[model samples]
Target: MRIPKLASVFLLMACLVAYLTYVKWHIEGIKPALFKVPYQHSGTESDDDKQTSPDLSSDRFQYGIMFDAGSTGTRIHIFKFLLEENEPPKLSHETFKAIKPGLSAYADDPDKCREGIEELMEVAKGTVPESLWNSTPLVLKATAGLRLLPGEKATQLLDKVREVFEESPFLAKGDSVSIMDGTDEGISAWITVNFLIGELNDSDGATVGMLDLGGGSTQITFSPQDKTIQTSPIDYITSLQMFNRTHTLYSHSYLGLGLMSARLAILGGVEGQPLGGSQELVSPCLSPDFEDRWEHAEVVYTVKGQKAGEPVYESCYNKVEKVLYRKVKKAEEAKEMNFYASSYYYDRAVDIGAIDENIGGVIKVNDYSEAAKKVCNSIVETPQEHPFLCLDLTYISVLLQELGFPKDNVLKLARQINHVETSWALGATFHYIESLSRQQMTEHTGKEDKMAALSAQ
Candidate 1:
């Protein structure tokens, strides 16, 4: 009751300072600690660690898995992408694994296909973080091999793959597993090559064409300088819209024109047809003295070379011409376009030392023809190490010419571009992501419209 006024005022000011200090500690320190506790218990990193660590959210790395089901093999591609807002995603890493004998081999026993699919799924599961398992998309696109199978059998195998996909944690849309149309196969491959080379999105960038040879089909796709729709067959032209631009590409896939299928055809063996009892397929394309058993589509055929008469190249050329002549429509526009030939095209070129396996190289259409003649002529004198080499080389030579590549027209043979396999899977994945984004945008716009209408009301 007898306290001085100055001392009382000092005590009051000191209490106010203490109250403000407590409030600051609660708001800036204790609240952050409480929020951070959950992240620590959730087993994620602390806030400080997250700030320093690699960003794993929407703005950074994402992944997609694609399965390529071909006639000879099933391959899985686990692609890791670096995403930036308003920019195209960049492929950072790719994990590719392949299992042999293809999914089509299990057509009769559809249940057996599950093991291979599950094995490939494990690769995807390992590549993508567990946190993103539910969000990552998984897709399988079967090509000519499955397309050639009986409808009932192909359906059974696809159904089993769908079941396996459903059991996995990844996002599996209803249309994720299906047979890819041959035209789409060509277009997807074109997208992959052009995208990898940075031409797909660039308005002024020059685009190269693609030639992909699989086991049961071969595809040629290119954008013509002159609109092909005016002169080319309507069936050969495909219009694709990408990156806000429409590309009228001359794209076609030749069924039964692939190396293996062509071999059977050249040998006069019909696809899906069994030979007469104990009969052998004799062909001039083989070495005169050679005889062996060849296996295709789970059936064994006795194959032998015909007796030597004229020069090997001359006779072999005649037989190969029968398979190529008038069988594939020639694209006059392809004569002017640069093409990147891959898949079996690369394999065959590398086999005969026409191109380097690692660095890749370019060769003229006549290079194949010359190589064929050399191989064919030599096989008769000295038995060839590979019986099919002569035939394969001849087929490729004649096939290119039939497709309208002149003798001097050059083609680039490569197995990979920018450390990624030159295949359609990458392009298909890009298409899938774009489709998803477009769908999400449409839904978002619809929602916004509804909200705006309500506000106006």
Candidate 2:
């Protein structure tokens, strides 16, 4: 809303002042290149995990809504920020909710995606106060799952979401609903890790690397040590600007190298194309005579194992090697960085008692190998709780080695840092809000100048 002449100048000044305050809150973290998920949810909780709200007034707070549309499921994050202070904004309260059968599930029936999208919106409406609904930005970012779909199908799905977003009370930008680029995904994940670790606030502190294993893709990102950098591919290096400082990060996302996709490949089944009929997919990765059913990318396959003979770990390793060999680029620099691995890495580590679910733990590269050997050995004697456990452990060990991490090198794995869950969404929120602020300033300048001239006359 604009006021007459003199008032417009004051409004412009106000916008400028507001933008300056937000800069100290946002620029300390991620920049927009600048960048997807499993659905996990809980009720409203403060920074202390209690139901109590801060003493801040409603007008003094800002909120952001992010929908992580992943292959396996969809999740919504409603975040509230305390913005009245001159210092960096504190994440005061958050509400999260998730639903299965991601948007990609309705590829053929795109419009059917409405029910789920609207359901998530209901959560946002309840979490974000109505007064701030129009000010809060709503965004949905699809990841590898959507990218793997046919061009026309992906476009259709995104269009369907755009329609829902348009009707919501929250602010929606032109690119609000779309498939996120893989490279940006890695960079954003890297930002999430550093931000959570407080590395972004300390200009001179060393930051960490990030390893994210999703159902459709995997990403690796970090700031490489100058001398440790090798002849990496040109596309693997990208420059990021934060706090007005340039950071050249080693980053990449392998579309098909994710744990789920790799498992599907190891089982000898194609992604969209299932075995034409009753043909069962067989592999040495499973226990001898082991028979089971598994579903991937909406296709169900009958999978089993080879006859028991050689050591189970060795047999599984052979299969895992073929799936990963020469596929992952080795980064010598990753070994020197303190890497934080999450997603399936954290899940599998918990499954094997290597890490506690709540606190997580540290492990050397060989820890995977040891876990794989132990698990694989027992699976041969009896039916294991998780049939894919052997293959997963073996695959992770080999994949790490392929990426140039030696057996002795250590990595810290976690699902969260402090009380808040670790995720790329936090980093992305800052980027989105900052972009929105810049757009407003640009639009404000011309209008303000025109009004100032009219006032003088």
Model 1's number of clashes is: 0
Q: Candidate 2, residues 1-457: lDDT per residue as tens digits?
A: 4457779888877866676566545543222221001122357643544324445457666788999998878999887766543344446556888999888888999999999999999999878889999999999999867887899999999998999999999999898887888777878878777866778656788999988887768888989866545577878888865533567899889888888889999888777777888748887778887898887776788898888888888888888888887889988877777898888988988998888989999878898899999989888788888989999999989988888789998888887776567778776776677667556655655565665576557
| TM-score of each prediction | 0.84, 0.83
RMSD of 2: 6.7
Collision pairs in model 2: 35-184
lDDT of 1: 0.80
Model 2 gets an lDDT of 0.79
Cα distance off (Å), candidate 2, residue 411: 1.8
lDDT of 1 by residue, 228-287 (tens): 668888888778766446788888888889888899998989888868896589999998
For model 1, the stretches where C-alpha displacement exceeds 4 angstroms are 1-58, 452-457
- lDDT per prediction? 0.80, 0.79
Cα deviation of 452, candidate 1, in Å = 4.5
